[model samples]
Target: MRGAHSTADTAVQAPPHWLRTLALLLICAAYLQGGLVKLFDFGGAVAEMQHFGIAPAEPAAIAVIALELVAPAMIVLGVWRWLAALALAAFTLAATLMANRYWDAPPEARFMLMNAFYEHLGLCGAFLLIVWEDLRARRARRDRAMLAGTKGSALQ
Candidate 1:
């Protein structure tokens, strides 16, 4: 077994932290812009909520803007990322279903609406993957800690 590679040794390494951070920041840009825009154009944001048939449009607009802002920041900063990802995923799914009702669209508009629906679904999948990655990393860290403790106690 000398000099032989194990499965763990052959596993692919993750990209550098800076690269991962940059990618996450880039992914969050759209959400940051959206939240800022909504905040800046309060009336328009409210109208948009009304257009989506969200009751009490003002409060709904505020809630959505808050989510858009907070969730993306949490994700980018790697703080409670799994929770943020799950929140964004749920928001995206609800928005997609409400906004992209392709079945109700006029024949001429249905294709574009369907495309948008699928695109949002893809975003949902991406967020879910974020949640999965976060959970996996947490579990790995915990396992490593437990392993280290076991070895330390054994050596003592």
Candidate 2:
């Protein structure tokens, strides 16, 4: 009985390959697409930011554009994902604040603010998905190890 494998021991295997691939794809695509858009039409984005009460449009626009474009690539490659996520999350938070600050503007003028809030939520969701998948995979690996250890001990 000392080395008997418990039910919990068999349940903790790494997550299925497909799930991990799907999660990676979804996060990469969403983040990369947004980054590309910001990078390509940067001037328009700066002008829009000005409309939202952001001052000194040129520098802010340049910084945000760079962060959006580069961070997504870093995150997708799984190199410096945590840092990229942090930067992106911070950017999203700023956008949200900008949006709220202009909430009382004319309906047409508020579109950017609304879009910023939605995009921020989407990025946050993607980050959470990556974290959840990572956790599941780790849990599964632990379970598999536990089962293997139990079985080996029983045979000794």
Candidate 3:
């Protein structure tokens, strides 16, 4: 009985590879679209920055577009994913606060802005989960290597 398998354990299964890929793609979808849109329309990007009252609109626009593009790539490729996800989380939170401004919306407009604000906050939470999972995986790998090294030394 000590070595017996549990029914729940047997039933639990990892998702298919394609499904995982699709999920990551969906998470990055908005960022990819925004970056592409901004890259193709420099004037519009600048206008958006200006609309947000960000000084030096062009530089601000360029920086945002760069992060929107770079972070998603790093996340999908598993390269410094924790850092990329953390960056995205911070960016999303900042952008939501700057753009949503639900608290300042008029009575009729408050509902929409409030919804958008919370939706963007949900995105921030997702990005944070990515960061958390990546860091957890890295720590696990480190611990495993250390354990393996100890076992090797014992055998020697």
- Top-scoring candidate (TM-score): 1
Candidate 2: segments with Cα more than 4 A from true spot = 1-8, 16-21, 100-119, 125-156
Write the residue-wise lDDT of candidate 3 on 64-148 in tens digits.
Answer: 9999999999988889998998999999999999998989998999999999999999999998988898898799899999999
lDDT per model, in order? Answer: 0.92, 0.70, 0.91
Which candidate's lDDT is highest?
A: 1
Q: Tell me the spans in candidate 3 whose CA falls farther than 4 Å from its real position.
A: 1-13
**On residues 17-64, what C-alpha lDDT tens digit does candidate 2 reach at each position?**
677556665666655675577678887878877987687987877777
Model 1 pairs in collision? none
Error of 2 at 54 (Å): 2.3
Instruction: Please write out the lDDT profile of model 1 over residues 70-115, one tens digit for every residue.
Output: 9999998989999999999998899889999999999999999999
